[model samples]
Target: MQGNKIFIEERLNDGPGKMRCRINFRFYMLLLSAVYFTMLYIFHGNLQSETQKPDRNKLSMGVEMQNAFLKIQPPIDIKRKVLASHQEFVEITASRLHVQQVFTTSGAKRNDIEVENSIISTKRTSQMIQKTSECFLPAVTPNRTFQTIEPTFYVYSAYLDRRYNDRFVRIMALLSLNKGNRQLKVSCSFRNSSGSIVETTANFYELCENHGRMYGGFILSCPIPNSDVCHVNVSLQIKPVHRNYVVPETVQVRLPVTQLGWQEFPDQTSGQHENHGQHATFDMPYNFSICVPPLFGDIDVMRFVEFLELNRILGFQHFIFYVSTIKNPDMYKILDHYKKMGIVTIIEWALPSNIRSGQIWYNGQLSAHNDCLYRAMSLTQYLAIIDLDEFIVPHNGEITLTNLIPKLFDDKVCGLSFNSAFYDKKFSKSTSTSRLLTARHTGRSAIFSKVRTKVLIKPSKIFEVGIHHISKPAAEDFKVDKVDTSVAYLHHYRDCVPNYGMKCKDFVEDNTLLNTTSQLEDNISSVLKLVFKERKKQE
Candidate 1:
């Protein structure tokens, strides 16, 4: 009994020690779990912090900022070198861009001179500025501070190409000056993968056609320092060099810098070398079409919109424009807006290096027109070659062009001709006029007294198209039909703005053209109102 009691005491002491050991083990495990969770939290935080670091790449400048940047210091001289005939050319991926100037007149005019030549104008003091509300004109005073109007620029089209040769770096730019002839100093830069720049600078000569309209084309055939050049930026800085009397302020026009390896192709016609192997397969061929060649001068936006809408209403499915340049930002925006809907196709119309300067018309317009014709032959059944200022309106009850085309078609007829009728701006007179949003014909009668002839042809039938007619005339191949005057006609609103001592006195008042008989008038107005309404709603 004594031995049994001693054993029980020893067992009780061992039990307390065992409980203590177990408690100590549990405390150690809990401490380890806390440390592991703390380590995990720290590691996760570090990873997140690393990911949240700001990017170190160079940022692109906004339009206004870039325009402002042009006014800085000694003009930036971007230089380039062309490849020799024998040297092996380096092929790098580059972006193609179409840069155009945005020309706008400031309300402040220089001395409010009405004459074409500023020097020849007679200065009259204390003139009463007549304000009228016929076209919502704003009230103005004869004495207002006038600042020199500087041109602004923007890139309209861009595309990526893998097979880019340094020899083919042709930069096409459209410049419109309010005053005297301006010269451009062009600078080009190529950026490699490592962010190093290789630059070249040169003076770009103004290329003009017989019509005296001028534009710029620079052939940059320079050797790029890096074989792996990924991007190219061209800056065409305008310094009114010719106008020695008036010091033109610096304005840097930024063309698009190509980003390498990014896959983006512009919506170009199939004939262009750039369109090779990347032609988008279409479900159905375009039926009726319109092709407008590259525009050089400042575009009237309101008129452009009306032109597109009226044609669309007339049932032209596809519209193509060989766009060299446009000065209006609103016009560019509207073109892009329509492009998204597949209603318009914009192609950059730069003269290829092989073509001589004389081969083009009105600053490479003829070549562009011919190219457009060739491009449309395979894609469209019929193409109406016209300008933004010209419209084909049906005189018959038939509203849509699609409806009227079949009635005029015959076994031998390859094209159709419409008598061109020109309208004077005085017929649609407006005192308070803003061309960007308001139609030129808002308050005018539908009177068009003068008439000339224009042509619309089957793309397959014609080999070449001229400014006024379709040609490459072969007795067996070419057959054109003239539409009856009572059926249809072409409406051309040519330049009617009078200069000093010149007046637009030829137009007469008539309502037969656009009032009750013409379907184009109602269709155009309704569509424009609807478009403006939708745009306002979105705004």
Candidate 2:
């Protein structure tokens, strides 16, 4: 009985110890499972981070590149400050016009001078004073010519454009002062028939934005309330933008204002003006005209003839040539002959003594084009600003621009842009019996999109002109249409392709220029013979 009692006590003690062991074992297993799940989560997170590392690096690189670009080409409004006088005008015209803070790439601001109920007057002491609207009309006195200042900017031409209801004078000029970086305040002094001077501030705009050239083109828009102005003088007030820069003396240019007729005429019977009505009953002198860029250097006489004759056959009635330098005397005789025939108008494009011939964008071709645009605005229905070697040829056996233009342009369209197909001189083949250069060059490089393209725009509908496109259109509804290559393309004849490391190998046969080769050759030969014969007589 004593042995049995000792055995039961031992069994009860061993049962409690076995339960404690089981509980300890379960706690260890739970801790190990948690550690294993945490390791797996950490591994997955590391893999995801590695996959996204390249995107983060690229984003950082993009930010660095943007910083570098900002350093190289600064924003247009860098360090821009508004003049007190200009600021006052900005406040007055704020509701009427969108006052833009104009500045150049060189960190100079061009303040838009908009005046309301104010006029600029000069007293006997030769001091400019601001007067109220009551003093807008000065006493009718003898017209006095202001002393001409030294030439700072080359003024090409000025015109009084009354095409829109708002009458403004447009001055086309080359911004040749201080490498196109100098900031100068511009104003216009208008002299009416009564010999009174009315001075007003002008708005300036650069046509080309840092085209990688030292010089640039500008258009000075001077708004005049009254259109009865005989002469307008441009006055420049020089101000130094940089600390080390020296300010030049104030310069003045006197320009004769060529007045243009209004787009719509008042009804004679009712004496009421109509908006967007039929055009004035005046006859347009030319249906289609071409504005050739500043002509310089050694020009191939044969190629010149071909350019004019082919375009003439394609319904170009007039050609305006801005002559910088003609190396060949025969070219002069040809231009003179065409001038006498009333088919060509030559303007002397002499640059300033300090400016080089080809330094500015193709010898200030943008200025010349803008000048030609205004000059031809009143005369031609369509104006094409193209280089000497480029030609707009129609496809599908279309000959004249008369038919093609109607199909391409409507009332809503104002500008037509054409892509270029370069006719490399090396790949030219003598395919035609007429032996014309355009006819011989049948193989052209593949058509490129927006590469060295040219435009044909309605001169009246264009507000600002550029080398390859229109900078501003006259109306918001008037948009540019990119003509399909299947219809037409620009025939750009050059010695080499423009792209770097591009072999002039891939070429397609385009003989659309040969459509009018027979007539072109006859006209060119006749012109050449006449010009040479006349040259012999002069010699």
Candidate 3:
């Protein structure tokens, strides 16, 4: 102890002694730290490279480029297109009500009848829905829904959605207002931003169901929009009202609708066959004379076929196909095919040679006939002048032309015209037996008038009326037999791709009516054979 004390005293007594001790202690500590750090560093480096695995979400230095080339893209809507918004209304009508004879044939009874225990009978047998019980429908003009055209309006409240996460929600108080102009009472309580009851900056708000009924307008708390309009929450309410005043369970007798959807949809189309009186032989009542009109031109042949088919389906016993301007070979091919099908009677179009010279429109047999339509009445009973592309195939096959068009004899229907369409492109999307047809929706040009054929002509009828050539479909003809899309349709040859045009020229060259408007005119000019220069390189 004495020796240690003496050594400590000596270190405190002199500067050289203390400085030497301090240096030795510092060297030893540095040496120890270097050894410990080297060992720790080696172990940590080994642990990280061996145990740490790759992560899937980690961005790597490389990515695949081939995936970008294989992605599929969306196609453009080709059938029909409209910019912005499209609104459509479909009203269920009495015609939509399909009624079958539970115990009798269709002609045996009429529409509007009550059921009897022994046998079911009908009184007024149209497709209009019969009122069974008082319905909840509001009183409006034209009680029939098919013709209901009351004015209605709706109001959309403005709101701002402030929340970033919420997209939409359902509210129990939302009222679907049907009747207009009577809303007067409502109540709700709500609070707003800035700790106030109705401040604009409030986030939590509520409607007091009573006070906010009509004009107060339900305020919605919404988030500020970073880009788009921020929609907020809203509520509505209406008092409960009793129902049961009108009829229920309206039956609809629907005819198949099968027209190819065109740019203009044909909603008011006829689908039923004619219904003539039952007081005739074979139980048939009407006679129809059908033919292709020379005015219908070469392009209207398909409409003729459809009209004739419909006439027969509606019980037209007698048919006359009046052949007028004559037809090209292609038109004849279509006619001949229908003829071989054991279809119905047909009369070819014929013109008196002298009158033919005078332009049939000016001097034909019915030129002065009944102000444009009924003049041909003397030549036939009921007439269904149709184009070739149209076919009136009935679903039930019970009604025929005579049964469907008794009014044709009435001279009321002046003229009825069906519709045809044209696709903007030069082809059809149809893959049926009519594939590769020039008359497809992607049809060819109708400019070429080869051998003009005219066969369909109706003398005049109150039901069979005027030209639908260049206008939208009319509403009056909704009762006519509606052609089905499948078994029966107007196979519009005008929509054809103009298949074999050069081939047609050869066949029609000798025929009358079309006298080569332009004969094989090639406008391409070839001077000194310079056009062939580009092809020389491949050789």
Top of the candidates by lDDT: 2
lDDT of each: 0.47, 0.63, 0.28
On TM-score, the candidate that comes out on top is 2
Model 3, 175-293: lDDT tens digits are 21233533313222223333233212323222222222221112223332232221122222333343432312222111111110011111112333122222111111123445443
Task: Give the C-alpha miss distance for residue 539 in model 3, angstroms.
Answer: 56
Order the candidates by TM-score, highest first — what do you get?
Answer: 2, 1, 3
Query: Weakest 10 consecutive residues, lDDT, candidate 3?
Result: 254-263
Cα RMSD, model 1: 19.4
- Candidate 3 residue spans exceeding 4 A from truth: 1-289, 294-318, 325-382, 392-417, 422-427, 433-491, 495-539
In candidate 3, position 269 carries an lDDT of: 24
Model 3: how far residue 55 lies from native, Å? 99
**Model 1: per-residue Cα lDDT at residue 320:** 85
lDDT of 2 by residue, 1-539 (tens): 36645654465477658666555556656777889899999999897665544342344535555455446552222211212343344234332222111211012211133111111100110111122111111111111121334444666566676655567888776665354445677789876556677788878788864376656777888888744654577877776667777776666767655444335321212223235555642435456779898798888888888888778667676788888878987788778666544456677777766666456767777777887787766556688889888888787567777678867877667789998877876676655555677877778875454756789987777788788887887666678999888788788888656574344667777767666766666666666766687678978
Q: Report the Cα lDDT for residue 174, model 2.
A: 69
Query: Which sequence of candidate numbers ranks them by lDDT, best first?
Result: 2, 1, 3
Which runs of model 1 end up more than 4 angstroms from their true locations?
1-284, 352-360, 428-452, 473-475, 495-539
